[model samples]
Target chain A: MKISILRKKLDDKEISAVELTRLYLDRISAADKLTDAYLYVNYDGAIKAAQSAQTIIDAKQSRPFTGIPIALKDNLCTFDMPTTCSSKMLDGFVPPYDATVVAKLRGQGAVFLGKLNMDEFAMGASTKTSYYKKTKNPYDLTRVPGGSSGGSAAAVSVGLCAAALGSDTGGSIRQPASFCGITGHRPTYGFVSRSGCIAFASSLDQIGPLADTADDCAALLTATAGRDIYDQTTADKTFDLKKSDKGIKGKRFGLIKELMGKEVDKDVSAAVKKAAEWFINAGAVVEEVSLPMLTHAVPIYYLISSAEAASNLAKFDGVRYGFRPEKTLNFFDMISKSRDEGFGWEVKRRIMLGSYALCSGYYDDYYKRAIKLCGIIKSQYAEAFKKYDALLSPVAPTTAYPFDKLPDDPAQMYLADICTVSAALAGLPSLSTPCGYDKDGMPIGLMITGKRFDDAAVLSAAGAYEKEFVRKPPQLKGVSEMKL
Target chain B: MKSDISIKWLGNLSKIKFDDDGLKKMAADMQSIMTLMDSLLLVEPVEFEDGTEFCGLDALRADTVRDSFDPELLVSQAKDSKDGCFVIPKIL
Candidate 1:
């Protein structure tokens, strides 16, 4: 069920918040077995929070997310729950404080359903890297839900939660949402505070929402976005998310030529093109525009993101709040052994790659060169934005693939992130909305990106498209929409 | 390229060790990823104009004293702690 309808029913007292929470809890208990979407389910805490929400509603002091059940990507710290980042490195470690977004939602009386899973330290394109469990796409139990926000997408896709908070470094939220046939938004860089989010690629990581609709995502962002003194990178800006005012008349959209080219699957390209035709018919001008630097996005993203990740992840030395080796020689040996045992293969691969890029001799050749190319991609995006209101493209080259598909070459998986990383590199607002499905009935995502800080407009464009396109929920056996 | 970008060297730098089997797997994985990294060679070495301004010291907030997490609360999260301090291996 959508948050808007739930809000009305909750206000009318037809169904209590506690009842709603129980319904979702029951659904998760039934469905999450196959999806493996949640890392932890705070059953007692959710019920306790819902009782408080009922009290607030009775007194007529309900906040925007009052009584609403929502889940969080495991990276976001919740003082009451473990913030593992789906890695054993921080297993059983509960943060002392809530993340900025979590604090905001708690203040709004949002009931925390639980923490969802993700790629270990947000490293891989699929949640297969998670140390706990690999989240399956709700649409097909065998296929992966793209990561590192795979659990967030899967949970929201199957209605395990009303919505979920996810962090996007390199298409983590968007790609997974695309694979799961849900709406996800990666707010412009610095738009959302990342104070308590476990650092992945600090520069590119921005927490956003995955929900059933673009308007629902906007509601979550409206509550969480703003400057926090703790995170100085958060922009001193705000967005007016007027759900009723979202319209596409007289706007311009650029169909990114490189994203819809021969390299993309025919079914995926067809869906995106059909979305363009929809925009054109709805009084919006659509054109094919080229941004050649986009070809360099995947490599540039890997180099820059990994370099930053190497620096950001240096604090996990096993002495403080995470796993420790059973036996060790000394201080260095202890730290190394703990990290080796704690982290998974993907995390180690990224750390090695990142350390290589940042090494003394290779810094200028790899890291600095990638930064310069990143600047070029930013300029190309700025030029394109001058001619268009928003850009449209496929979220990924194809739909979600089966597990163990990239066993030999992990680079093949990273290369597929080309369609979404340019927006992250440029700090632009981008979202993935379900456009259509492939021949195999797998969902395809149409990504809509706009200029930095033009997040409201980007969402409005997606909302406009969503009004015409009816999203199909996963037909998995246990998945059922709430009758309320 | 595999020899030049040694997995052993990278493992040492990253403070990660691998057994023989792990080393073999890592080498094969790194080689495949390095092939992707080679695409970086195609990019021209031109310095594109970036409009980022240095937000020097002024960007920082005022250093006003505020409440911090209690020492006991902070230390309680440590894997091993005693007397409000984290317990680590003694350094020589």
Candidate 2:
């Protein structure tokens, strides 16, 4: 059930917080065997929190997210649960304090369902690299749920939780949401605090929400966003959460041409076209706009992201809180063996590439140049937003692919990030919602991006399309019904 | 493009080792990718200061600990803890 539906049920006293939590836990028990969405479920702690919330509800003290069950991506530090990031590196590491987002969600009396799985250290586009089992697409068990927020998306998609929090460095949330056919919102950079999230790329990371609907995502975003003393990068401005049906009357939307090329799957293009038609029919003006820098976005994103990742991951030595190798014949051996044993192949590959890019003699030629290119891309997006109220595109080239069908070449894997990287570079707000399905009955998503800090407009436009669009996925057909 | 720079140098700085074949393959792959990225050089040069940039680090406030927990609590989570400190293999 959606967050709003749960809120209504709670308000009507039809279900207590403890009851709702048990119902979701039961649903997860029934469904997550197929989806593999959670890395750890905090059964006792969640039950305690739900009982506390029940006490508050009995006393009629209701908070915004009171009694709503939410899932956290494993990268976010939770004081009471293991935050593994689906990696052996942090297998037994548990923080003594909660992430700022987790603290806020708890303050609102939201029940923490569990820590969901993710790409190890939030590094990969698919959760297959996770040391834990792969998160299966809720839409089709044989296919991958996209990552690094794969489990977060899958949990909400399969109704294991009311909503989920995910971190998006480069389409981690939006891409997975699209693959799962759910609504995911990546708020403008600094809109949500990142104090306790395990760092991927500090400058690019933002925590977002995945839910069944745009309105639900908006509510969760509102609850989680705004300034935090611990997170100096968080914005001081507040996001207005009440759904305003600002019908897209005379709003200018640019359909990014670079995102709709021959590389995109035919069904994805059709879904985007249908979304554009819905916008036009709703009285918004649609025009094709060029973002030439977008052609190089995937490469630029990889270079910069890897460089940042190299520095961020240096903390995972055989020291302090993480996994350590028992064979410490020497210090170097200790570090090497710990990393080799703990990290997956994909994580090690990026760390190596990133270190190489940021190394002396090559810094100016690769890392510095990529930063300059990022500046250019940011400006290009600014120029486009000046001409358009928001931009529209396909969230991914295609829907979820079968688990074993992915290409062997690393560059081909990187190519999967093609359409979603530009907004990430600009640190702009974007949303993905189900628009249509392909012949295989897999869902396709339409991405809507707004100017930086214009999260409301992005959500409003997405909500408008959601209300007017005709081709939504049919009622919850569980994974067993999928052809694959 | 510098001949003096070898995969050994890169690997040393990165703290990871690769087989000779892996080094050669990665170098060739990265070179081809970088060559394609050379297209960005064709864009008209604009004054860097004139462009809209992200809100700078200047906007950030000085670091102040908003909340402090017992350091022992943090040390307790470490795999190897001794004398209220995280123990690591000697690097020196």
Candidate 3:
């Protein structure tokens, strides 16, 4: 059910908060066996929160998110639940406080279902790198839910939660949401605060929402977005959640010529074309625009993000809150052994790559050059935005693929981020909304990106498309047949 | 180009170690990624156009004293804590 409908039911007292929470927890108990969406299930905590919400509802002091059941990606810190980031490096570490977003949601009376799985330190595109269980696509169990936000998207896809919070470094949120057929939005870089979120690439990481629709994403974003004293990168502006009556009528959208290349699956390209046609038929203008710098977004994003990640991750030296080695020779040896054993292969690989990129001999040739190229990519987006209000492209080159399909080379996997990385590089607001289904009935996502801080406009464009598109839910194995 | 990158040197810089097999695997993976990074050379180093968004230092909130995490709670997550201090290997 949609958040709006849930609100109406909650307000009218058709069901108590406890009953609603129980229903969702039951669904998770049954369905998550196949999906493997949650890392920890906070059954008692959720029930206790539900009781509190019931009291508030009885007192007529309910807020926008009162009684809402939301799951957090494991990267977001929670005081009570473990925020492992699905990595052994943080095997048992729980923060003393909640992340800024989690705090906001809790203050508004949102029930904490559990922590969802994600890529280890948000390193890999597929959640396979997670030290925990791999999250499977609800649409097809054999395939992966795109990651590192795979668990968040999968949970929402299988009705495990009303919505989930996900972090996007390079296509993490949107790619998984696309694979699972949900709406995921990475708000403008600073639209949401990053305080207490386990940093991967500080410059690129933004916590976003994965929901069934754009309006739901807008509601979540509105409730959570604001300037935080803790996160200086947050914008000073407020996210005023007003109705966007300004539909796609007469608005101009650009179809990025670079994104719809031969690399994109024909069905995925077709879906984008169909979305453009829908816009054109709806009295909007659609044009093919070029951003050639986008072709290098993959390399540029990896270089810069890894460089930031290496620095951000230097804190995990085993002395403080994370996993520690039992036997070591000295302080240096302790830290080295702890890290070498604690981190997964992918995490270590990125750290090594990041260290090399920032090394004295290679800094200018790699990191500095990537930053300069990033500037050119951003300028290209600026040029395009001067004419078009938003751009349209496929979320991924293809629909969700079977496990172990890509070659062992990580570059082969990183290259799949071609379409979504540019928006992140430019600090633009990008969203993935289900556009069509592939031959195997897997959903394809059409990415809509707007200029920086034009987040509401980007969401409005997505909401417009969502209103007309018919959404179908995945038939989860044990839970779909059960009537709550 | 791949041979020039020393895995041992990077492992030392990152403070993470690798065995012989792990080193070989890390080297191979590093080579693949570096080859991908080489594509940046294809783009001419055009004049830098600082398109990065900046909130500026002026936007920072005034630093002020406020209640912080309770020391007891902060130290609770540490693997080894005694007398409100994290127990670490003695550097000396």
Q: Give model 2's docking category.
A: acceptable
Which 10-residue span in candidate 1 chain A carries the lowest summed lDDT? A237-246
For all predictions, the C-alpha RMSD in Å is 1.6, 3.0, 1.3
Per-residue lDDT tens digits for candidate 2, residues B1-92, read: 34566656665566555567767765765555444444444544343542554543457676676667777887886778787788776768
Model 3's chain B yields a TM-score of 0.83
Candidate 1 falls in which docking quality class? medium
lDDT by residue (A1-484, candidate 1, tens digit) is 7899999889889999999999999999999999999999999999999999999999988888999999999999999999999989999999999999999999989999999999999988789899999899989999999999999999999999999999999999999999999999999888889999999898899999999999899999899988788888887766678843557899989999988778899999999999999999999999999999998899899988988888787788888778888789998998888888998998888888889889988888889889889899988888898899899999999899999675557788788999999999998889999999999889999999997778888889888889889877789885667676
Instruction: Kindly report which residue stretches of model 1 are placed more than 4 angstroms away from their true locations once superposed.
Output: A243-246, B52-58
- Give candidate 1's root-mean-square deviation (CA, Å): 1.6
In model 3 chain A, the worst 10-residue window by lDDT is A475-484
> A220-335 in candidate 2: lDDT tens per residue?
88888888877777777777756544657999999999999999999899879988998888899999999987888887888788889888888887677787867667778777
Report lDDT (Cα) of residue A106, candidate 2: 98
Model 2 pairs in collision: none
Candidate 3 docking band: medium
Ranking by TM-score: 3, 1, 2
What share of the reference contacts is kept in model 2? 0.34
Interface RMSD of each: 2.1, 3.0, 1.6
Error of 2 at A369 (Å): 1.1
Candidate 3 TM-score to native: 0.98
